[model samples]
Target: MVELNEVFETNTMIRDENLDVRTITMGIGLLDCCDSDVDILCDNIYKKITAVAKDLVKIGDEIGIDYGIPIINKRISVTPISLVGASSCRTRNDFVKIAETLERAACNVGVNFLGGYSALVQKGMSAADRLLIESIPYALANTEHICSSVSLASTKTGIDMDAVKLMGRVIKETAEATKDRDSIGCAKLVVFCNPADDNPFMAGAFHGVTETDTVINVGVSGPGVVKNAISKVKGQNFEVLCETVKKTAFKVTRVGQLVAKEASRRLNVPFGIVDLSLAPTPAIGDSIADIIQEMGVEYVGAPGTTAALAILNDQVKKGGVMASSYVGGLSGAFIPVSEDRSMAYAAEIGALSIDKLEAMTCVCSVGLDMIPIPGDTPAETISGIIADEMAIGMVNQKTTAVRLIPVIGKKAGETVEFGGLLGNSTIMPVNKYGCKDFIDRGGRIPAPIHSFKN
Candidate 1:
């Protein structure tokens, strides 16, 4: 039970620390909506999503108002459309039609984003998976509010280099398809290694087959709260700093638990899990970099940046588990470049490079998120980058993903404005060296020997 003192503490977090529930995502399974006819299948999908999520926005708003907590986004995740549309979708256009239906449903239901226009090709690709991956550029370009992800690697199955090579081309095509809008389509696409089923965050959330028909998942944000808590312990030893962070994360996550239960009760959906991710926004105080700096780093991406991130990530999880009975999803510090103001600043000043960001991902939540490269980057180069990240996740047996935006008509030093929660970013340079020969060797990378644990 939450004590009265805890209620007051949560109020302080909200009032001063930019505390908010990042997203209240509803995961709707679409296996039941499958049909042999394309039009009929699209109709079934549209109807099911609309009906299931009609009240999601209303309930989320009411919850935020009643509890005086800010719920920033109401979103939805559906079963991967590649599987649902495979029997009926004869061509890439047919899958694009499904994407349009998803966008329409998301708009109708008043949700900001609808994820799961996705394909799973971790080990290899089915014909349907290949079609979905090929269609992603057109699908995402033609629609707004629809997000797509493709899984190309996993710890147990290893990396699918065929899919990796294909996705590198797909990402380039996606950027070209939406070049008029700052290549925003690529922003909605994610490539994953070891993707999770119940992740409340996007652009890589999908309802895994293991989930219930419908459920509510909450992603909580409290980087500012953490930063504030750590500041008070300045000059203290590492032990004191770690304990302070843990206690701060505990208080922040308790608020999330309260909101999740209330939302689940009101919406009449099973409470799935509370994602205790310290999601950072473009806002000044709400930055993972700032928290790292408060922990005494000179700047993010400095010499000791990775170590600071490791401490923050571990303590956040340790404390969050104490607060919530079910804590899943990518629960750690997020260091998305364009989304965090301090990280963006660091990148612009050359204090942070793509290499440093990649190194930091080894210790953080996700990999290479919202990073903008030059417009002329080669597809093979992008694939090489994805391969490196996939290898990390496969070896470490953790979730990692890539969301890269190659802004068209822009060079490394220029800035592209996506605005809103996506924020703006100065294009970071990539290594000019060619990796075409390496990427051309398209076959599976065998799973590590450690994966033999039965």
Candidate 2:
């Protein structure tokens, strides 16, 4: 475990400030909750969750206070609802009820978010799955704390054009449904390609079938620590910045590994991966973009910002791997436009462009995240971006995902503030060129040549 009082010398690359882990999610496998009767299955799920997770918030708070490091969120992820409810849910209403139960369970425990109300129909969708997908807008808008996601592609089965189209429509409706609340409900939703099973982050986490019955995973976030490391060497050369990031990330991941193991031990659950993502908050001076800007750029999205981010991302992975044997999730620097204040500022000033953002995703954690587009942008355009990012991940055989917000009645350059953790961002323009023909191809883009290891 990381010693909180390890004092640092002024010249050391690593220094512990207010750095802390964001959330340590406990995923409880709910596949056994499946039943022939929808109501009975829902009842069983609520009972199981309530019984086991009743003390989640209390226990997490105790640990956080004891360690003097704030655990910002305590949450849970369950098996994808479509999989767990496959035997029970014959109609869309049944899925909605199940979603409601999940929401209520989270609220009962004071957990802020409950993920895995999702499906993994990367290649195709079953009828029940399709209905569940269609109902996301209503479910998310109406529920208080439910999050949803769908994996539309993987390195093995490739991208599913039809599922992508349906998800695009769902994204649009989800935005409209919560437009009154600045689309706050939409913030709880994520669309993924090559999603990770042990992710402790919000909006994209799920308990995959291969996971233990229950496991606790921690997501340690330290953008301020990383920014501090970069700022200390502002006038240094690029190589110096990379080395600084690697050394700082080593210390940061050490803290995460310690926190994760301790939390799991306290909970009496098996320890899971430590998601070493540089997840940002709306707080000023606490962003990955700020780190890049501190490294000599006038602002984020300047000429060398993407390259700098690439270096930071790589070094973080290298250092984190050395610190923990169980490093996983989207473990890198996240450049979500809305989540990072500097990223939003860059987009507002036109320093960041869609193409540049796409390139950044090639090296960073996820793709096209928290990006808002003009409401009128065609569904095909959304599918095009999804396809493009998924293609990159598939070809590279790494996890990449998109969590776009098609902000209704909002256009490029317009700023929308969702408030709180969702943060604020100026909308970005998408390519005007149409992709109707490509999207209409509407079949799996076969797994890349390199994916065939056998």
Which candidate's lDDT is highest?
1
Model 2 misplaced regions, further than 4 Å: 1-5, 8-18
In terms of lDDT, model 1 sits at 0.93
Residue 28, model 1: lDDT of: 98
lDDT (Cα atoms) of all candidates against the true structure: 0.93, 0.84
Segments of candidate 1 deviating more than 4 angstroms: 1-4
Largest TM-score belongs to which candidate? 1
Deviation from native of the Cα of residue 169 in model 1, angstroms: 0.6
lDDT of 1 by residue, 1-454 (tens): 7689978888899999999999999999999999999999989999999998999999999999998999999999999989998899878999999999999999999999999999999899988899989999999988989999999999999999999999999999999999999999998999999999999998999999899999999999999999999999999999999999899898888888988999999999999999999989998899999999998988898899999999999999999999999999999988899999999999998999999999999999889999999989999999999999999999999999999998889999999888888988899999999999999999999999999999
User: In model 1, what are the clashing residue pairs, if there are any?
Assistant: none
Per-model TM values vs. the true structure: 0.99, 0.95
lDDT of 2 by residue, 137-158 (tens): 9899889778898898889888
